[model samples]
Target: MRTRGSLFRILGLCLLAGALVAGTLLPVVALAGVVTNEASETVESLSAELADEPPPLVTTITDRNGDPVATLYDQYRIPTAAEEISDAMKWALISVEDRRFYEHHGVDWKGTVRAALNNTSGGDTQGASTLTQQYVKNYLINVIYRNDKAGQQRAQETSITRKLAEARIAIQLETTMSKDEILVGYLNVVEFSRQVYGVGAAARSYFGTTPDKLTVAQGALLAGMANNPSIYDPWSHPERALERRDFVIDKMVENRKLSEEDAERVKDEPLGVLPDGPDKPAANCVGAGPENGFFCQYVEDYLLEHGMKKDDLYTGGYTIRTTMDPVANHAAKESAEQQVDKTEENVANTLSLVKPGKDRHEVVALAANRDYGPDAAAGQTEFALPSAISNVTGTGSSYKVFTAAAAMERGVAGIHDTVQSPSRHVSDVFVGGGEQCPTVARGTRAYCVTNASEGGSGSMTLQTALQTSPNTAFVILEEQAGMRAVLDMANRLGMRKTMASNAATGGAPDPDAESAEARQSQLEFFGPSENSPGKGSFTLGVSPTSGLELANVAATILSGGVWCPPTPIGEITDRDGKPRPLQEEQCEQAVPEGLANTLAVGMSKDDLPGGTAHAAAQGVGWNRPMIGKTGTTQHNGSAAFVGGTPQLAGAAMVFRPDRPYGGLVDGGPGNVRATDGDSGNMFGGKTPARTWFGAVSKILEGQEVLPLPAADPRYERVN
Candidate 1:
């Protein structure tokens, strides 16, 4: 209903003044297809015939494929002069709004006199301004020329002097325009609510229909809501709205606008409203756990990082074309949710999947706590950690996937490179002690061991260490690769973005600074380095990272080391129906396909029984194999499963946020349990695996999954 921005800008003279002024013209003279009439003349003539104009209103919602999901509006419009306006609406508006609508051309002298009398009486505030005057105030005045909050406030405030000025403007408008023209302007320019401006919005918001199609009772209701809408809004206050509507119907019957039967029928009709508006997520994932909430939060954060406004997420009326398929997303969520129940440990899980050369991705599943709330899941207080979707854990053993890729990409080491896994010492180790930590490999001088911790696998290749996820194996590799090399590789693979602690503001940070000795102690590494002292435990997957973080860690390998900015929105169109093109982000290749293949081949070891991901391999066919890893922190409290099909990459996480520090000191290790309830065996293979499988299967039901491009050129059997 509001005029286009360009048109408003072009005619800014009358609007420049503090008062709102609008001019209307009728067809008084016709020459060469140009109809001309004096604005004053149309306003001054009450008997002149007017052309019909039915305002257009559209409601549309589309799917990811740009197909119409739903539509609620007029399919076609056939205008006619005899198309009578609702008499009840006219009289209700005229009675309390403009009693002199049919009299005085546009300006009502008698009404103005009465308004002045009422003002002087000083009993209650009253306005004698006509509808034409009100339309001018809503559009021209509010749309332009106002500056500063005070100016805006003043314009909004209706007063006696303003009413008088409005009368003069209304008279001018009526003199130059036909009655129908004035009516059209009035219908178009009126403000129904904050965003519900004009009759079109009012129709949808209230009766859920277009203006022309409104029934007599519905028309009366809309007319009643014209002034002080909030008090009579049917959705918010149905009783009051119905009372006001009945008042309009009564007035129409009194004015002979409608017969007694029509009035009775319409007044008794039940009010119904159409549902079409933005639905905000309750907390994060719609009464779901933290894993989903966190992922949604991650998407929000990504948008913010890309310079999008927070308001846009809720009210921008934008359709986001995400790389996520709803089916896959639902499947993943179901799988993860179902899996979380199997684990007695207090934990959460999240998974994401992406396909090759496609914009559609899937967030398979996420479950934050063992149960939802206190006395809700299992009467456990440990479930109280904030379940917001952004609380991603630190990448534990999954970090090696990156480290190995970094070595391969930089040529620091090859998949065939020899490393002693059983050796006692290596580099950049963060935990464990001297003699007890056996040196499986010989490289730098910090004691390290396999993840199993029994003894080293003797001597093994770098690929073997990766497949086995040995603690000492990765330490020796990291030592040889150097911290700078490892960090460089991490940076290339989007690891910097995964560091939740490094956020600018509103992020969690260490409360107290560490002592000088503690800082020095933290800097020690297992690899031989001039900058870092040797301490080896880097390969055990002892680090921390969120499901998304680890998912992307695997995603880098899945994507052939080419990083693409994940997005939910595809294209944005303006009100004028013009598409705004978004720049396609260029891909950044972080590692060679050959190296990625080596890791993929090793990761495929999960299909074998001795492999960490043996559970995931149990029921799947050989047509499209699942390649991924299963990680468990020292305590059984946290577990993760990261894997993907040829088309998608996703990660699922499960952890106990409330477990006391290590929890081992307590007889039961507090929230960090190794098994669920009485099962005595709880691992990622159970719940996390089920969630991962369910989601993956549902998502890939009918879709084709391309084979992952080989990462190692030297490995002939990789394909």
Candidate 2:
């Protein structure tokens, strides 16, 4: 109805309104473009940093039962393949995190717009970042945390600038990595709880199961926990965890990913988390239980000394199974602790058991009255050996067994060979150019040795002399047998060139002694170290040896001269679960089978009726065909018993009262009596022999008893 000029004015005003709206929107559109471009640049930089290189995996060690003994790791991650991730878990994450994930690129435009509108409209501040953006952000946080403080700060800061940058990077990342790759990256790096950084760890730490094994309820529960792990810890807040879990289930049901009936059913189910979750396994011998700690530590040391890469222990995912018989080990421990006198600080007694046959593998059962550690449970000054291989005691009369074998090998004597032993001998020890025996000062250049029983028995067979452990006969026997033959025989039976564990028997000089430097300055020949024991008294049990080494020697005789070097490792597997080649067994025939059998007969239970180790023949209850010998070094400072059956072989030793560190693991110094509770002297023929009997009896408890060869044919053929 108005005039034409009025109509023009109204049209102009409507046009102006349109112009104002366009002007208002232009800056916002342009601003979005600029922000997206900047975000893309930041994402590009971050993508280059995230190589998706997973952290080191944990190396688990298990026992014979596949029970976990130890777990070695810097980060406790048990990585699994993506295929193991449950579909239910994936859906739970998608429903909670990115509803429009499949349709959108990495940035999820629909989600971002909705979130922005809700935030501006006085609603909940929704972080509509897609899974891809979340993954990119987490990776950036990881990279920045390790190497760049500024990058970390920017990643953590809550600002529009940061959000835009993450979106651009997320979009670019979508073009590079597939959806699954981004999802896996997210699963591996997402922090589920304190000291626990991945969904794999979360499943194990919370549900005590693997990702593939997760049920719908458990999957949803774990995914729900990822929201606010600190405030809603399943372990710390069971009520909160239940509430969040139900919420996730509701979301899945609302999305029709899960049926309403199934959702309701799972909602009422308990969290079903293991009470303590995953048990953190101990990593080393220090925590491998008090009973097995020393043995574990010994295996660790033995591997390093025998050429295992030390660093591989921590980084390599190796599954190493050892040759330790827990039954035998426990038996030996019980015997050593019970038979030996605990009252004496220096009265150290230990028993070792070895089973080495072509059929049955060699296993070391090294057990002592006191644990292998510093300080004794009852005393301050005790014999504490740092390693199972450390030779803390002398070989003692056990060395004579080797001498007898040497004599038979050279055909100088037979089991029935006859000799008349004199109370005293004044003859030069025929060493040729080798070292001479250290003895008391006498008028003659030759060493004069007397018998413990003055006026040596008139006439006795070689077996009789051995059974009596008569020094004069053995010395005379050694003179006829030749020292070189004995030395070679000992070496073949697992004796190292350097037989000294310390300076007591002329080994590497005692550094604690003023004369240590001079001793270390001594010349070396067969041994790498000058600490080698003196040669003169080699047959008199002067050489130092460990119980494990002695066990090898006895096992040689038991295996009919086939000497197998003691080994702890049964098998080793690499990080990739491939079997790694271990050192081959170094077995050799040190003596003829006939000679070994003959010696076994001479030291057999029947033979012991007239032998020094006769008491060993009378075992507590076991009647297995056993052969053994008793040993006592000078002044009875150390005693030993080496014995074995066709199935088991080993040695037991006891140190003198004055022998420091020989009886005490770690204790204040004290003196042990020469005898035990019943006034029984700590003789190798007594306590050590008793310990051996008890130990081997337990080892052979239910095994079949075997018989020795009636007579070694080689002995009959001897002239």
Model 2 regions lying over 4 Å from their true place: 1-75, 81-278, 341-348, 358-361, 371-387, 419-421, 424-427, 430-459, 497-534, 575-577, 605-607, 616-619, 635-637, 655-680, 710-719
> TM-score winner among the candidates?
1
Name the best candidate (by lDDT): 2
TM-score of each: 0.71, 0.65
What is the TM-score (0 to 1) of candidate 1?
0.71
Residue-by-residue lDDT tens digits, candidate 2, 217-240: 888877887777777677788899
Total colliding residue pairs, candidate 1 = 75
121-176 per-residue lDDT for model 1 (tens digits): 77566665677666656553333312236544544444444444444455555555
Instruction: Let me know the TM-score candidate 2 reaches against the reference structure.
Output: 0.65
Per-residue lDDT value at 568 in model 1: 45
